[model samples]
Target: MLRSSIYHRPKNNFAYAYDEETLHIRLQAQKGDLQDVTLIHGDPYIWENGEWIYSTSSMKLVGSDDLFDYWQAIIRPPHARLRYGFICNDGKESLTYTERGFFEDVPTHCHYYFAFPFLNKIDVFSPPSWVKDTVWYQIFPERFGNGNPKLNPTNTLSWGETPTQSSFFGGDFEGVINHLDHLIELGINGIYFTPIFKAMTNHKYDTIDYFEIDPHFGDKETFKRLVDECHKRDIKIMLDAVFNHSGYYFEPFQDVIKYGESSKYKDWFHIAKFPLNPGNQLSYRTFSFEPTMPKLNTENKDVQNYLLEVAEYWIREFDIDGWRLDVANEVDHHFWRLFRNRVKAIKPDAYILGEIWHDAMPWLQGDQFDAVMNYRFTNAAIDFFAKKQTTVEQFQNELVHVLQSYPQHVNEVAFNLLGSHDTARILTVCEEDTNRLKLLYLFQLSFTGTPCIYYGDEIGMTGGDDPLCRKCMEWDENKQDLELFHFVQKLISLRQQSPAFSKGEFSFHAINESLVSYRKTLGDEELLIIINPTNRSLKVKFPTSFADSIDLWTNKHVSNDLMLNENEFVIMRKMK
Candidate 1:
């Protein structure tokens, strides 16, 4: 029976409150070991005539990785308290699993079951509801466009020039306003700008001032205009907040450098030694050991107030839609809690996205950020679609692990991205193979979570990591890959048109070394997504139930035995 594989816990993703009335319970068993599981649950206090009451609900196999199969069932307790246990059967054998241990037979005692205690409404992980339908477009402001060349830095190079660490091309808010039509054409509903605040570097992570826009980007009026313009076009704007650290030249940090001990603002940062050392030795904590970027002491009351003011100022002044926190993990939880409260108070529906590259359950508990950057999803996609290093089964397993790591609501709104300012562009990652990139986009757009497209990705811009990836947007029609652009646009259109793409239940129905297929079902509307990443053509046979299906991508009717070309993919809508 592989009894050792059976596992459950009372809290976290294993079991959680989906809402005030609904409790989500999850059980883990060895992959393919348990034929089925039934959740034995009820309000722990519900009793009649010297006997406790309970009900049994079947648990569906929600997801599986390399080692474990995750089983889930949604239960609504009338009393908002839950006591639950599992009755697992593996064809011939059956057993009851509980908090204490396993039982040969179903345990009747309430003490043997796991208890949720009570479901508090405040404890529910309620992120902004609008995030599920959002499609984000990430823009590195300096590299996006040059609307006003007059505001260019002294050594600013011409647009489309090869980029270096120090080069700038004066991409201002006006440029973004000028190109709103392009984004509208691509069907982007949200824009995430990487650190538009005033800073020393072209990439403005080192915040010189939180309140003002970078000169290269534009003034506050220009930014406000841009925000209004974006809102007018139904596009939400999310600005990056780099509260984890400030630039070396920041006034408070500079004061510390001037008066090591007596500076009133000395506690604003984590300064270890008296004599300020910028580069030689690590005198103070910095972002990834870069001395120019001094880490902020968020725990201090003064620093917290300062950052919180920054958080509220943007929404109150410019009416920005959200804040994408930079280095959000390094910051303390207390500050994030306060930050969420302050931001939500200003704009309740404002989206808060954290830049977390790994497991972000701690930050995503509804108290802090609504979603994270979803780098785990990005890495898995790159490994399978770009690097070709993982098998389809392995990729699906990795995805299952990610999906099961969070609650259903969190997963729906998670910030899914293929390429960003940090990583190499998607086309470059796929080695300029537009076919492979197309397949990657197909999967991302059809899969769960709110998908994001990096700036210039739709037009097939290709570059390597960091400075290279942050190249100027290719505005020349001759240079842009319009075919790829239309393909991405079509994918976004499909996502918007189909409820199955955004809010459907996701399940991988078929997987192999070369082919990966999944189904998204919401009500009667079903979407079957099939991707072929290999170089050889393959004949994919669909079930007789899918005999009448239409390809959403091409609007053509597909037969049961669909012959997919090399590196081809399709989104088929099942006919009613």
Candidate 2:
């Protein structure tokens, strides 16, 4: 046996309480080194006649990455406490593993095993339940619509003009209010807007003021009306909070620049040296070397109080539903923890989504963000569906790794997206192949987590990265691809109506280089999703036995054999 391959830690993702009653435990071994693993667990205090009573549960091979195979099992400890160890086996030999060390046989003493002292309900990661059901629409506010052409900036180009980083098309709160019916028709239940606070640029990531809406977007009353209108339609609104840094022109940063070391706000930012220099050369900390965005010193108490007030003021004043924090990874955890307390106190169900592009396990422990901008999901989808850089098996493995990186509840509410303001549009990334784009959307809408659609994505808008991706919303019915829009609408409707699509257990049934098949099962309702990413027609076998099935997409009945056309996908529901 490859005993050295066995690995386990008693905390974090490996072993953590999923809820007050349920405990999730995991073990990792070198890829393909172990045939199976069994978790032997029980309460540490439960001893009768000098013997510790225990229960054994088989651990399934949940996921495997390039180097490791992950084994997982969910257990319920009667008293909310657990002592556990693993029994690993290869085809040829078996070994016992425990907290103290590896053993030849099961240890008789309970002290030798790992222990979870108690499961605290307070520590369990709990995001708002509404998030799982939400279909998010991400809007770059300045480009969404021009409801008030009067508010257009001096250099504003006509609507539908290609966007530049500094272009202003006068998309305001009134524009969003006028288009509530459009989002309603699109089946979007949640709207995530980029930074809308007063700022110099059209994109508005750099904030000049946190409390007031930008003049380009609208005034306070206009925003309140927009929030009211959205709530009437049952659409939740999430505004962006850019607390990681402030714009160069922000009052505090400007004061620092003007007064140098004598400024009372000198400690508000990270200054490498006094007499601030705003250029390519090093001086103060900035966001990605951009001198215009000076990083905030969140550790400062005054800074924390100011930002926290900004956090609570919006929720209390506008009745906003959530906050999507920008550059959240850069902010101090202490500030976020306090931020969570302040926000949740006013609205317990308010969703806090962080803009974290990478692994966010550290911030997702029920203390900070409810979810993050799932850029990992975007990268994987692009690699598999757009770039064809990975095989079906490899894509499935990577996806499984992502899912297993967090608890099941966290995975359910993860903010999954295909394109965003920061990246190339999905259509552009797919080389303008609408078929590939459709396949990508099909997978995204049906997969786990809360799926987000970048504005203009469903309408077949295509552009390159950054400023290009932030183009104006195409409102002309004649120019929009209504077919693609309806297709996406159907996907959203299916996600809403079917429990199997939203809350089902996922497993790959069959996988290959060109085609992949997966199943989402929840009790009696089972759905099979099959995709063909290649250009040639292929005959793919159904991995599960089915007598009669209806294609959820087209309502076509199927029996025995299935043939998929080039770039086609299908979701089938088994009929009893």
Candidate 3:
């Protein structure tokens, strides 16, 4: 009696039916030194459709010359799907059948065909493209709060010059999970955590170990709880994935430093004869001149495999929503290509963002990342309305270019943010102009792409950069900017009802020295937003066609026509 012999790795004891239309399988199987593996379909391996079928007739091996040796097959079934396996030709064995495994989940309903078998269970997951449309809020873990005092760093010091990077002030992951209501109140749907991986520093970007969460951040359970709670609230989490470099105490780097290149991990880094030569300065073999931040040689296969495993580990262990790849352009594309596949393979709806502040067209050509930070738009808004350094037309042009630079898919995914942890706070950028701040806030919530608001900007928080930008959360009763806060709240409410703010197609109307207007329309919804960037009150009339529009934000009905006073913005909705 020939009992069915099946070999399945990871032994989840279950599999899904594969879609006939999307039969492109990205297998991560190790092959012989021959550089390619063949799948001979149409052989009867497992009992299905009242008979056993083999491999040679099913899939055609793809990318035989490339490093990823993937395969694609198209099999049309008489009904829908069937169980099948491969006649794997690994140059040694001719008809060696891999053990029968569980069913593979198919994405959509396709005509049932004979089931196909492969080495690994085909797991279907792809990151969603709409993730970029989410409004992001970046939280600096340390300054955010101390939900639990026990998690605080051992050494605490006053806020002053020459601050030690390793010292922490008690902000933990639980703090973020607790204050999510505060963020929701501000109309942000996504949160970009600086870094939570285990490390000696408070920031944690210098990763000592990629697999473990920092005990200071409350361990794996806290992070898993945070991810679950956030998802329930319709919010997304973007973790900071620091692959550009590792901290001084990283295991692999430590191995190299201690063993003097004799260790197997020596190939993981680019080494010099005098690897620790301080005189070499910029040319030294560390990450971008930071001696503590040692750069990983991504071109090496071992390094790529290790980092990819780390990426998959998080999505599997913590169920994180997505990742913000820090210094993405600096890392090698070869590594990113493999990295993207591994990430999307786990959570097809996950998002991958790059931290490039300038034009990243070369990297965003559909293969590199889903989107990059929109510093250009943020700067333009700051200059024209906040600093008054440029004319409205210039600002308008900058906004147009931001959209035109990428495809519609990429444009909608771009992170539209102003005043991140790296820049001056929005309040400071606007020079404390309550009116200008209102206008900017109105625009951000109404503009295209995902909007990101730095913490405390709504309450008129002002800071320059670094230490100034990283102030602790101010629960001060006397200093809260209620008026500004309410205005922002109103703008956010308007955005919730306005398609132009969320998914509308945008078009520029007019942009002058002191005025700029744009229109956004999605399906049946239409909106016209006009801004006046001056101090003294200035009245501007809308076109005759939009005369019957109503100001949803202000609740001021425009029966015939409307006017925008100085520094005033009118969000007019087209009446049915």
Best by TM-score: 1
Off by over 4 Å in 2: 511-513
Best prediction by lDDT: 1
Global Cα RMSD, each model = 1.3, 1.5, 15.4
Stretches of candidate 1 above 4 Å error?
511-513
lDDT of 2: 0.88
lDDT of 3 by residue, 1-576 (tens): 011322222111112222332232222233222223333334233446654443445444322221223334444434333343433444543443333322233212111222344322233222265563577788888777677777766775543223343555777888888788877786777888888888887778789998888888888888889989898888888889999888888898888777864778887877665345435463336656877787888899999999899889988887888889988878988788788889988987778888888988766754567778877878888887788898766676677656644444566667877787777777887787778877887777777777877777878878887667777666564787978877877766666666666767677676344677888788777888777777666556677767767777667776543445688777777844
Better of 1 and 2 by TM-score: 1
For candidate 1, give the lDDT. Answer: 0.89
Q: Please give the ranking of all candidate structures by TM-score, highest first, separated by commas.
A: 1, 2, 3
- Model 1: number of clashes? 0
Candidate 1 on 283-328: residue-level lDDT in tens?
8989989999999999999999999999999899999999999999
- Scored against the true structure, residue 274 in model 3 reaches a CA lDDT of 39
Candidate 2 displacement at residue 252 in angstroms: 1.3
For candidate 2, write residues 1-576 as lDDT tens digits. 777878888877888887778988999898999999999998888888999989899999877777788899999999999999999998887888999988878987789999898998888888999988899999988999888887888888888887778888888888888888889999999999999998999888889998888998878989889888889888999999999999888999988888899999999999989778877786999999998999999999999999999999999999999999999999989899999999999999999999999999999888998999888888998999998899887888788789878877888888999999999999999998888889999888888899999999999999998889999898999989999999999889998889898777777676455787788888889998889988799876674565467888888876556778899877889733
Better of 2 and 3 by TM-score: 2
